[model samples]
Target chain A: MDFFHVLVVLLESTIRVSVPLIFAALAGLFTERAGIFDIGLEGKMLGAAFAAGAVAAVTQSVWMGLLAAILISIALSLVHGYASITQRGNQIVSGVAINFIVAGSTVILGEAWFRQGGRTPALGEGARFQTITFPYADSIREIPILGPIYSDLLSGHFILTYVAFAMVPISWWILYRTRFGLRLRAVGENPGAVDTAGISVIWMRYRAVICCGILCGFAGAYLSLAMTAGFVKGMTAGKGYIALAALIFAKWRPFNIMLACLLFGFLDALAIRLQGNPLPLIGQVPVQLMQALPYILTVILLAGFIGKAIPPKAGGVPYVKER
Target chain B: MSTPYAKLPGWAEYGLIPLVNLAVAFLVAGLVVLLVGENPLEAAYHLINGAFGRGEYLGFTLYYATTFIFTGLAVAVAFHAGLFNIGGEGQAYVGGIGVALACLWLDQTMPWFVVFPLAILGSAFFGAAWAFLPGWLQAKRGSHIVITTIMFNFIASSLMVYLLTRVLKPLGSMSPQTRTFAEGGQLPKLDWLLAIFGLDIGTAPFNVSFLLALVAAFCVWLLIWRTKLGYEMRTMGHSPSAARYAGMSESRITVITMMISGALAGMMALNPIMGEQGRMQLDFVQGAGFVGIAVALMGRSHPAGIIPAAVLFGMLYQGGAEISFEMPSISRDMIVIIQGLVILFAGALENMFRPAIARLFAMQSRRSAVVAQTKGA
Candidate 1:
């Protein structure tokens, strides 16, 4: 293949792989903006993936699987909300607990329900998200650069991929332009001020957490029904953490989040492509190094080697009403 | 309306509350067992029996507990300094490299006794070094330790995989592990210690590491409760602003505390590498570092409580393995579920029952005060 074709393929795969990261990073943006540190994003995504895969396999309805994924993820989010918000507990500990619970429960429940060794049956075509080919893709292929870019790179993506891309602008509008978004951001930065304005800080945080749940649910469904045929054991495979790194790397901005996710996704695609492939001077690049790049970059960014990425002022502290 | 805050007595605060939380965790776990279509009571019986039924079972339980103690103390020490050290898993993993290097170098030349101390030092140094960057980042660079530590975990996993597969793997070896260590590298089994109780620890990997764990626990207690640095750590943990106001260096304490925690976590590798596996291998830590979080929270970050909590988890692990053997439907993941529940109840939902219990205590104290007034009248 020519260099251009390889580049197109690489970018296409980057978009495909980044779909989950986009969903998850947006999910994190909502919660972190509302001052709730949701380390449980991994667990929520995993739970949703299992639920979607199992329900889709059993009912053979993609809609039902999506519904199940959303519900289960929301339920887990509420558990986090209860511990961190209502009980005024340590948010990190609550998130960690949720992660562990979901990680263990998904396997146990999957095994018990499916009898397939912690995996659901392979999903049918109807039960999985079908890719949508953009109009005029076949006829436009005769053109040189733009034709392949339109047909191969942009077209023939699963619906969730489009939805993930669409969410960026919607999230940007919701976080920056809307009234609720303003309140949510205000609550995260200063719950005391939001509370003084008679807007309920607790309710604002709950809403943000639920929004996080919805986005994570979509991320999970994308993993099981859109990315692959079915859910394997531990299929999320630290993508949630990568999403978190991307979120931090982006400094929790919607457009920046998308850019970060795409960057990380490109690294992932490159990692897979570069396995055992020799470069000009470097000889063989270790796939592990490629895999570790996003995290390494995130750490470097977090260490302020690049520009500073400050979290919300009240990011981890639980608000207590002082009489 | 919220109930008025009441100061709890030491016994209720430390002992009764934790027990209640533990009971709730176990009850939830039982519900999970029932959901899996098994007899919860029967599972409980089997679990207890598997942990303590025979000398061999007890030996295995203690063997697991030894690893937990090291990790638990690691978390607890960090907790004392108000830092959450979730990188125990990575630290422990890197610590294996230290133990392996020591053994690979001295195993064939030196006696076991001479090599043991060097291995301990090597593991501690590597573990501490692994943690140092995150600590420095948190202290000097103003980064969150939690995120950095978590990032370090993935980096450690990748580094270990590279080392084991490409660098450390012996020539012509199919497996991604080093060759078994020589006799000097192996820890002597503590069979005689168990035999003194008129019981044989048959084929258990229980070894001198158990005693090392105990000694470490004692040392941790001395460090935390009996030293000037311990007071500084406690002050910082209680209130960082107060610690700073008192002229304690925040950066120094944070870095030193993390190194101490990392050293303890690193020592955990000895239990498996020297005591049991006798060689470095992949994933030998096996979530033990995470288990330390549960142990520290359950034990209230005290060495006195950590030992018992670690042993309880050891029971759950040993028992869970037994249950999986006896029952086909239930897997070892059941223990993980229980562990999650324990962390949830004991760590996060710890205050769930505190208010009601405090109210009960308040009422009792009020009643006694009224009776005393009537008697004085």
Candidate 2:
């Protein structure tokens, strides 16, 4: 109704929309840090979303749904690691193949199991996530900036939304502070050195991939069970790629991933807000341009129009132990 | 990556392995269909009947094959140059813009013959223009070609959506498509060519574009295997340092190679715009460009391999539709699974069985050597 209320709504929408992206970006950070390029992030997320949504709809338990999603996504990760790490296959080709397989299989399996044309039955309230409320939030809403922040911005998001935001710091710690993080970074940079130091390069990469799978699983589960009610076809639609773009935009740093995903989320929220909203100078904006903005921005960033964005040096190259 | 020259005969290397992969994919597809409570054998029959055994359907199958051939060769050309151009989907989508503009401009004044060639060039030019930046970025900016190409695809799709809805839609028409092309914009069907040979068949969308696909294949073969530039591309793809030592400009070659690949992908619009739709429309390219990846990989990035592979996919597409038609339980997504399985086996798992085959070859040679030694003794 008022300008401040609108801003609060927009911020709320931004956080809500960015939950999956934050999870996915963190997921990509793990694999890419270990020198594995995971274009199949999209595929894994899609599979998990479908699995989570279907299981939750049937069993009416969000926890079991989340578990199923994690298992399925982990299975896909194993497939990718086996192909790229064990078989020494082309990583890009393997990723593309995984996308193809997951994209197709999710639909087929959904159709066979549910007979609902690639969608699960929408879940009940018990099967979907509930919002968390901060203490004494409603009583203080009459005040100005802090009131709206308390009432609209910080309060009443699905439980996973907080987890998604919290993951940024946790990821930062895991990637930059822990010994495993140090070893993972070194393994990606020089697997030979890690190998010489008595660490197994194959095992290290597998571990990174497993972490990636878990994060992506959370992202997918959130999309189906928390953000929305059921798994529609391709519900994770390009967010996986968007998270990937965010990954590169942040140069694979965890904190940077948060900033990038939030930025994308804000842009998405703005697009939704600006659907037919008019401005003083610009007049009513076209929906297409707003919809196209994120991609255009990514291209600009990637083309070195903004700044240099380099991936891990050894990313996409399969590590072969020449014995 | 190139495999060491196989000890197995050429047929076994090319034919046996791919066929085995196809068989495995089909077996998985059959199982999926059975899981949905359908008969796989009957489903296969229906697919065959829909693609070929049914009336005039072979023409449609070849029609779909024509588009695959173009996009497949686009991928193959880039592959041979050590570039992964996944943006073929985007390139082809943008190619529709070129064809649309050409038809809109020339239909009012020019003859069909003159307009057709001009439109063909227009499509290639536009598609190449779309791809030029990614190629340039890959060459000069040290960006990964696959990432840049993929990023370009999203941009292309969005750009096309904007162009269609905001710019190209006819006045008072809510639909995001241009008006039907005039006579000068249409390309004659292959039925006319077949009529010249006195072969009567029912009407289908099969067009002269199939012939163009064949000609393009021949030209691609010449360019890759016979030309100086072709030699440079292969050398570069195999080993970039070796190419640099041989005095080739790496950046120029990368740019040129991607442009050529983009042009080939762009040409696929001829069938949909000039042959099937006879007008500009949103989503003219569909998923054909993505499918081209599977085609190129399964074909081993060879023109010789790509043509047959394209035809086989064309069958799967047309037949998959038939399966979805007669049996409601086996939905359209089943076809996508089959396509994915084929990609999994043929591309990702390509080397999975090669070692075993090579072992067999080695064992046979060793047994013969043992027998010869005994005979000499």
Candidate 3:
């Protein structure tokens, strides 16, 4: 491909790969904003993906499957919230347990129910998301650079790509402008202060966790229904953790999170494209090197190799009533 | 006036929580079995029997326990240093690689006496070196150890996958594993010792690794309990500022602690490669490092305490395998549920039961004070 064609493909690939991460990153933002640390995003997303894929396969309806995934992910989030918040348990341990539970249980159930080792039967096109086209942009293919870029690169993404982009703005507005957002930030910073002002800390945290669950549900749907047409064992492959790192790298800002997600998505897309492609200049980098790009980025970002990023003051510390 | 009977002494205060934690853990595990449509009683019976019912199985349990003890100590050491070394899995892989390379490349030329110790040392060195980068980042750059170590794990696993698949495969085998080590590289099993107790059984895989594990545990206990360095680690884990004020080198301690933990984790591969496989395999150290976290938590991060905890976990692993065979319908995931519950209960009850005990003590003291005051008045 020529330079312009390569550029268009890169841009298109970036948007496609970034959609699920954007949803998951926004999910992390919602939980962490409300003063909760959610390392369980990966588990919730995987659980929902499995649930959505299996349900959609059986029901032959994508919407119903997506709804089911949302409900199941929310239930798992409740388990996480209750264990960490209600029982005064360690958030990390609770999150890790949720991951193991969902991972092991989903595979076990899949094998028992469908006689598949850890996968659901792939769904037909109608049962999965269809590519959404902007017809006007398609007609503009005759125009110069902007038209070609917009029409050729961006016009035929899955429906969820638009939604993932839209979520960034909605997340920004909700976190920065609303009364609930203020309370969420306040609670995260200091639950005692929020409680003294007559707000219930428990209820607020539950709301944050639920909001997180809903967003993660969408992320799961995007993965199972939009990105790929089915579920496989450990298909998430640590994307949730990558999203979590993106949350920190972005300093928990929605806009920054969007940018961070795009950067990671670009690297991921580049890696995928680079695989099995003979690049004349660089010779051949092992596929494993490309797979490890995001993690390497996370360690670099975490090491303050970029700049300082601070977490919420009360993150991971569950509120306990004092006598 | 006498101290109130309601209050537990210090030992009971520390000891009772773990027992209660164990009870709650087993109860939760039993409930999970029920959820999976198995008879909880029968499953539990099989679990216990599978672990300790036969002499051969018991040897397997001990062998499994050896790995846990090493990894658990590795985790506990870092825990004492107030560092979380999630890279144990990766470090262990590096250690395995080191042993494999030494055996494959060097064993032909070296004497058995030199090759064996060199293999152990090589494993430890690789593990320590693998951990050192993250430790350096954590100390020098203020990177969070949890994230850094986790990243290292992915890198390590990816590297191993590449090596096993493309680089390290034995000629003509195309399989994702290594060549069998030369005889000089193998560790000798203690069949005669077990035979003296009339319990020698199994396929001669049981070896001196168990003794090495216990000795490592004892050494760690000594390092933590008797030495100034151990005291500093414990203090630093509790509070960095306080440790620094007390003259501990934060950076030095971080690096040293992670290296030691990594070395200990690497030692685990010695058992499997030198004891069982006589070579490295793809399925080597599958999640044992992660399981070590649960073991360390359940053991309350104590060396002495970790022994029983490792044994408990080893039993669960062995029995989990056996139970899966007997009841093919129930997925082996029932073991993970049990493990998750054990970690949950142990973590939760540590904070939960402490205050409850304190309250009981306070109430007893108040009652005694009231009696003493009335008698005096």
Q: lDDT score, residue B299, model 2?
A: 94
Model 3, residue pairs in steric clash: none
Chain A of model 3 scored by TM-score: 0.95
Candidate 2 residue lDDT tens string, B1-377: 44453668788788888888788888988987787788999999989998887446777788889999999999999999999998999999998888888899988778778888888899999888878888998888887788878888888888888888888888899998888988888888777665675554477788878998999999999999999999999999999999999999999999999999999999999899988888878888878998898899889899999999999889888888888889887767776777777877887777777888778888898999999999999
What are the Cα lDDT values of the candidates? 0.93, 0.86, 0.82
* Candidate 1, A1-323: lDDT as tens digits: 38999999999999999999999999999999999998889999999999999999999999999999999999999999999998888888888888888888888888888889999999988999999999999999769999999999999999999999999999999999999999999999999999999999999999999999999999999999989888888899999999999999999899999999999999999999888888779899898899889999999999999999999999988888996
lDDT of predicted model 1: 0.93
- Residues A1-323 of candidate 3 have per-residue lDDT tens digits of 37787878887888888888899989989888777778788999999999899899999999987998899889988988887877767677777767776877777667666667778888898788999777798678878788878787778888788999999999988888999999998988999999999999999999999999998999998889988898887888888988887888898899999998998888888888888886789888788887777778778877787887777888888897664
Over B19-46, each residue of candidate 3 has an lDDT whose tens digit, in order, gives: 8777877887676666656798898888
Q: Write the per-residue lDDT of candidate 2 for residues A117-151, one digit (tens) a residue.
A: 88999899899888888888899888888988998
Superposition-based RMSD of candidate 2 using all C-alpha atoms, in angstroms: 1.9
C-alpha displacement of B36 in model 1, angstroms? 1.2
Candidate 3: C-alpha RMSD to true structure equals 3.9
**lDDT: the better of candidates 1 and 2:** 1
TM-score of 3: 0.90
Q: How close is candidate 1 to the true structure, as a TM-score?
A: 0.98
How well docked is model 3, in DockQ terms? Answer: 0.51
